[model samples]
Target: MDETTIQLLCPECTKDWQASPDDLPTPADMFHCPNCHASRRTSEFMRTDRDLQTLKQLG
Candidate 1:
């Protein structure tokens, strides 16, 4: 089976990671980086436009 995940980045700390779309909050919601605790809009953390779209569709 294939799995879909959202690629995330922390602009404040430059941390990167992946997470299931279902596990994340809405794209407009505040999201904190697990590594730096830097908080920002979830959409800002998305690695690409596609990633942001996926989150909007499945998050």
Candidate 2:
């Protein structure tokens, strides 16, 4: 079985990280960037089909 993950990018620092969608605390909660310590809502992260494809290829 293949596990799927969501890629999150920080707009402030432009850093990327990934985690299972289920692992997120809540949709209303903010995701904190480890690199720059910037906080943003999960929906604030930039997502694109190209990013999804890249993650799929990596897995």
Candidate 3:
């Protein structure tokens, strides 16, 4: 099966990347930017509300 991916944008650094939902924490968990290392709730990094919903459903 094709792996599920989610678009992520670092709210602090604006670094954009794609990651598999299975590799990430829940939407409410803390996330650190792989670029600047700035930390925030995982949902804050979602590129859009749709991305957030995808993460909520699949992350």
Candidate 4:
């Protein structure tokens, strides 16, 4: 399996983090920041600018 890195910006603390896509939770699951410890649904993180454009085009 290939590993992908996804960058996520923290809304609560304004921190940027990089996580592995393979280890990330599915659409029905959630992800937690290893630094600030804030948690949010995986789909919610997909709302990032990088992802938004692609997802929007796909929709």
Candidate 5:
């Protein structure tokens, strides 16, 4: 799959952050920062895999 970049904002702190495609979890999967215990939906932060596939084809 093609790599995509993503920027995410913390819902609780409004913290701005960025993560590459490799950093994301699977859909509906929980993400917790070991240091902050920050959690979020994988889909909330990255583009859908199907959408990425479409982008790859378009390009």
Candidate 6:
């Protein structure tokens, strides 16, 4: 089976990180960017075509 994962992007720094959805304890949980220390909800991250391509390559 394939593990479900999510990609997180920081609007402030444009940095990104990826992890399993389980890492988020709740729907309201906020993700902090390692690069910029800015935080935002997972839903707020923009999923661009490049991000989709990266996910495909990783998969």
Maximum-lDDT candidate: 1
TM-score, candidate number 3: 0.90
Best by TM-score: 1
lDDT of 3 by residue, 1-59 (tens): 98878999997788999998888899989989989999999999999898888888987
| Alpha carbon lDDT at 42, candidate 2 | 57
lDDT of 4 at 1: 80
The root-mean-square deviation over C-alpha atoms between each candidate and the true structure, in angstroms, is 0.6, 5.5, 0.9, 4.7, 6.0, 6.1
Ranked by lDDT from best down, the candidates are 1, 3, 2, 4, 6, 5
lDDT of 6 by residue, 1-59 (tens): 98866666677888776766555434345656678777785455535555444444443
lDDT of 4 by residue, 1-59 (tens): 85456666766676776665555666447567666777886556663766534433332
Model 1: CA > 4 A from native: none
Evaluated against the true structure, the overall lDDT of model 2 is 0.65
TM-score for each prediction?
0.95, 0.65, 0.90, 0.57, 0.53, 0.57
Worst 10 residues of 5 by lDDT: 50-59
Q: What is the Cα-based TM-score of model 4? A: 0.57
Better by lDDT, candidate 5 or 3: 3
lDDT of each: 0.92, 0.65, 0.89, 0.60, 0.53, 0.59
Q: Local error of candidate 4 at 46, Å? A: 4.2
Worst 10 residues of 3 by lDDT: 50-59
Candidate 3: what lDDT?
A: 0.89
Across 7-50, the per-residue lDDT of candidate 1 in tens digits comes to 99899999999999988999989989999999999999999999
lDDT of model number 6: 0.59
